[model samples]
Target chain A: MIAFRNVTHGYGDGPLLSDVSLTLPPGSFHFLTGPSGAGKSTFLKLCYRELMPIAGTVEIFGQDVSHMSRDAVAMARRKIGVVHQDCQFLDHLPLADNVALPLTVAGREANPEELKELLAWVGLSGHARARPPSLSGGERQRAALARAVITAPEMVLADEPTGNLDWDMSQRLLTLLVELNRMGKTILIATHDMNLIRTAKSQVAARVLRIRDRTVQHAGADL
Target chain B: MKAPLPRKFRLFGRDTRTDRVVPPSGAAAWLTLLTAAAMAFLAVFALALSVATGRLADRWSEALANGATVRISAPADQMATQTQRVLDILSVTPGVETARALDPAETQALLSPWFGPDLPVASLPIPQLIDIQETPQGFDAEGLRLRLSAEVPGATLDDHQRWRRPLVAAADRMRMLGLISLALIGAAMAAMVTLAAMAALSANGQVIRTLRLIGARDGYVARAFVRRFTTRTLTGAAAGTAVAMTAIALMPSAGDAGGFLTDIAFQGAEWLWPLTIPPLAAIVAFVATRTAALRSLRTVL
Candidate 1:
């Protein structure tokens, strides 16, 4: 669970998002939509403690994100899966190894069978031995997804995960996310694609939140 | 976080030793091996110099501190009389163990290198030398000198104190200088290795950033580099030490006509002393790299 109470974030002299109050409960599915530079990624980053709130409080699982120590934040991140916009991977490692990185960072053994099954689920079973740089955008996204879920985190946050995918590929990725939600993993996705938001709505009870005028608003009511 | 992970975790985790080895190319590994070997070679000699100087100081101080010589430079007829009188005085002296006049052949042997074996010592007015030996509770030089001056007016006493003091002092200073040089070499090695580690860390910024993005604690990331550099330094030091030891072992022994420089080597159990350098180097690398990594990580993060 995550709660941002009147949170305000900014760069040196400009406010990106201000007075943004929101709550994401367990097993909830939410879509964040906004135009370019709307602070969607920054908002998702705060959820996992990558960037701290400049003002106000961001809480995850009852611990204050801004107050948590570095180790505490790292341990907390083990329970939250984050897929970056670029779908970052350790380039030198094989795709399978990259996907198993979460388990590795957590100091847990990666079960070979479980890793194979996770790759299979991401449709990257054939690319297990392939290096991350050799994988296509879609494959990279799927691998990032696999990495995020490897620790069996309770929540998943993704930023434009379908940005480089075709319609069919986007749908396949969304279906994977929906299945995770069905299995009780809370999910929040930030995207600019309205079609993707509409598609996610029809499949699951996902609420759409739009960042406008430096504030988050319920999308259905406004647009 | 929970009671600190085992060293096995530190050892086998992809982050530490396995990740940084850069896959050994024969050339690179050999270069590392050679570097270690050469440094070790020099280090061994430095160690030997330090130990040998210490021994020389101890020997010079011990041998010269407890002995004196009496030389009588009179006519051959008076030489025998003066020698007998000096011996009579020494017989009553407190710490004089024995005083004996040198025979003609023994005197010639001392002068052979300078004046040749055919020098006419019987005709020329060379002084008759008395070789004096002393007990641990040595004779009073001033007291015996006064007695000899009164009894044998032509006698000149050489207690070896004037020359011995300076020789022992010089040896002691050389021993100190050798120790100081060894310390400076260790410091220089640490500084060089620290710079190398920092360069390596800077070169691998992407790796560090990736690790950080994945939520690795600073300690985990630091340990990766710390262990890496520690091993490199240890290996380097080991190679350096081995080459140094072997080269020192092959150095000319003092018994040979080897000059002082050639005679610089470990004696007795002094050889075991170089074994401590590798572990010491490892500790230095650990501390130096850890400080560099932590400082750099803090600045960037």
Candidate 2:
């Protein structure tokens, strides 16, 4: 769960998100929508304590982000999975190891069978031995998704999960996220994809939050 | 479901999944390895110098410690009388173990090195020399000087301290300089390794960012780099130490080179001293890399 109260953030030019207050309860599925460079990623970063709020408070799992130590942030991150549009990875490592990284870094022994199943679920079973540099964009997205949930994180924050994927691939990635939601894992995805939002809404109850005019607003019944 | 890693993958503890996160090859890796090897090589010679000077000091001290000389510079007519009086006074001196005047032939042999053997020793005004050996508790030079001045004005006591102190002091100072050189070498190695570590960390910025986003702690990230550098330094230093030790073992003995180098080598159990350099280099690399990694991780995170 994440809570942002009067949160203001920017990159020194002007306020990108100003006086924004929102509390994402446990197990809630929400989508953040905005144009390019509209501070969606910044919001997610604040959620995971990767960036500090210029004003006000941001809390993850009921703890204030400003007061958390580096290790505390790391601990919080273990329970909060992040999927990036770029799907960055240790490119030298194989796909399976990249997917299993969250567990590996968390000091949890990843079961080989379960890791294989997770890769299969994401349709990356055949590319398990392939390095990140060799994987296709869509494959990398799915691999990123697989990596995000490999540790069974309680909350998943994805920044444009299917940014570079095809429509069908996007829908497939949405379905996987929906499946995770059905498993009671909270998910917040930032995207400009209305079709994906519509597809996700039909499959499960979801809320859409739009970032505009430097604030987050509930865009319910509009999209 | 999992396949085995390649043979090269297991290098630098990549056998462990935790350590494989960072890509192993980089300029920093070789920097640390080569720096360690070169510094270790230089350090072996520095150690040899220190050890050799210390040995020199000890040998000089042992050879010159309990010995003194008496020179009679009286007129040719009185030389025998003054030499006899000097010997009689030294014979009764406490802690004087033995005192005997060298014969004319012995004196000629002593002077033969500087003056040719054909020199007329008995005709020349060469001083008569008396060799004096002392007990473990040696006689006081001031007391002996006073007695010799009153009893035999021509006789002067030479306890060897005038020249012995300077020789021993010079050797001791050389040993100190060698030790200081070794310390500087170690410090330079640490600095080189630190710079190399920072470069490696900077070059792997993407890897570090990716790892952190995946919930990896700073320590986890640092461990990957630390282990890699430490292992490289250890291996390189071991090789360097080996080569240096071999070179030292092949060096000429003390008697060779006209006794100028003065046993500049390890003797008996001293060979074990060079064996410690590799492990010490490993330790320096470990500390330097860890510190740089941790400090740089703070800034990155």
Candidate 3:
């Protein structure tokens, strides 16, 4: 449900992602792969309207990202879930409260049973009372994943979801993502892990895109 | 089956989840409270001064508006004749309510404070004084002065306007100054609150970023800070107002002491005015904090 038409972005320097045109259709699963500093995180930011494209237009759910007001951007974000590489959380809050934050910010009543089941699905049921800083890296990633899908958003954009996880933990996280895709949720993940890509391809029908030398290219059957 | 999640309490019509994200900045919180308290205390005094000066101006204007005094300075023998001539002139004046010359003993009473009660009144050269009372629509002092100068050259009419006008004007000016001081105090409080809120927002930059990333709107983020500062200001101002009202109540009454300082206090229903300070302080804090929070959130989110 996200479209970037010739979207060019930069940070006071030259363009990071130049003349990039891509479409993330509904119920589709895609992987973004490139080396370090290949503008992968920047691509996900544009998808969520965190950063506006300097050159062309970026659209989410058919609304122009650059034209949306601050409040409209926030409302649009509720429809798309984002899992960051750092797995940002309010360190002062417990893990359960952090995961329930999306519903809380939207001014909706949190269904305790649903929140519990979501936490259990991500295997963070026992760690609900724990703080973010107190949790292990892998546990934090799972908590982040649970938080992302807590709102039942239509699309999920994750930036290096398993950056800090081991091989088995990464596989487990991949399985959760695969299940979500099977349930008709669009998923786009950016990563540099080739093994994670290989594992994801065997589990689900997915296309791979890579960002290199300031442009996005469809990597053809290389994996 | 998964266990049910416990419901958290809602504060100020919103769930407390958003508020818990920002860690409390203890120093900034206390600074806002103390600033509000101090500003409120000063505001009470300013209100009192304005009210008291207004009363003083009204009293002076009413008492001195229609009254005049006739001072007769002449030879001892001619003083009686001049006084009689002045009295006769005043009796025909349309606005003159009553005119009576002061007796020797009454004149001595006026001088008792400076010359002691046993002053030699008969031998002294103090001028003969005649008190003149006017109707509600008073006579013209200039017209009467010309009449007395022709009929009784030694007689001089003083309608108390020379001194009364200045006294009334001074009181009115004091009232205006008191009001201006209250306005300045309010502005200063707002400025201090704005600075404190900005500091708190800056210190919690990470918290704001995290909240916005989770789809929290600017209003949601601003409310958390606004409610906190408003509550603190209200509580502190209440305490300050209580102390100020008690101090004002203990002040000497104007009727008993009869002086400027004694009159600088609340009288009757005027005590109810200071009670509004706490609520007003809360409003100021709400506006100041909301403005700072939203402005800072723009740069953050």
Model 3 residue runs over 4 Å out of place are: B1-15, B254-258
How do the residues A177-221 of candidate 2 rate in per-residue lDDT, one tens digit apiece? 888788888999999888899889999989999998999999968
A40 Cα displacement, candidate 2 (Å): 1.0
B71-126 per-residue lDDT for model 3 (tens digits): 99999988888888888899999899999999999999999989999999989888
**Global lDDT scores for all candidate models:** 0.79, 0.86, 0.87
Candidate 1 vs candidate 3: the lDDT winner is 3
Tell me the TM-score of model 1: 0.90
Candidate 1: give the clashing pairs: B36-B240, B40-B240, B40-B241, B41-B244
> Which candidate model has the greater TM-score, 1 or 3?
3
Worst 10 residues of 3 chain A by lDDT: A164-173
Query: Which CAPRI tier for candidate 2?
Result: medium
Off by over 4 Å in 1: B1-35, B254-256
DockQ of candidate 3 relative to the true structure: 0.69
TM-score of each: 0.90, 0.94, 0.94
- What are the candidates' interface root-mean-square deviations? 3.3, 1.0, 1.3
lDDT of 3 by residue, A1-223 (tens): 8899999999988999999999989999999988889899999999987788999999998999878888888888898889988888888888998999898889887799998998887778898899899998888988988889888888898999888888887888889889889999999999888888888889898889999889988899766
Which scores higher on DockQ, 1 or 3?
A: 3
Task: Tell me the deviation in Å of residue A131 in model 3.
Answer: 1.7
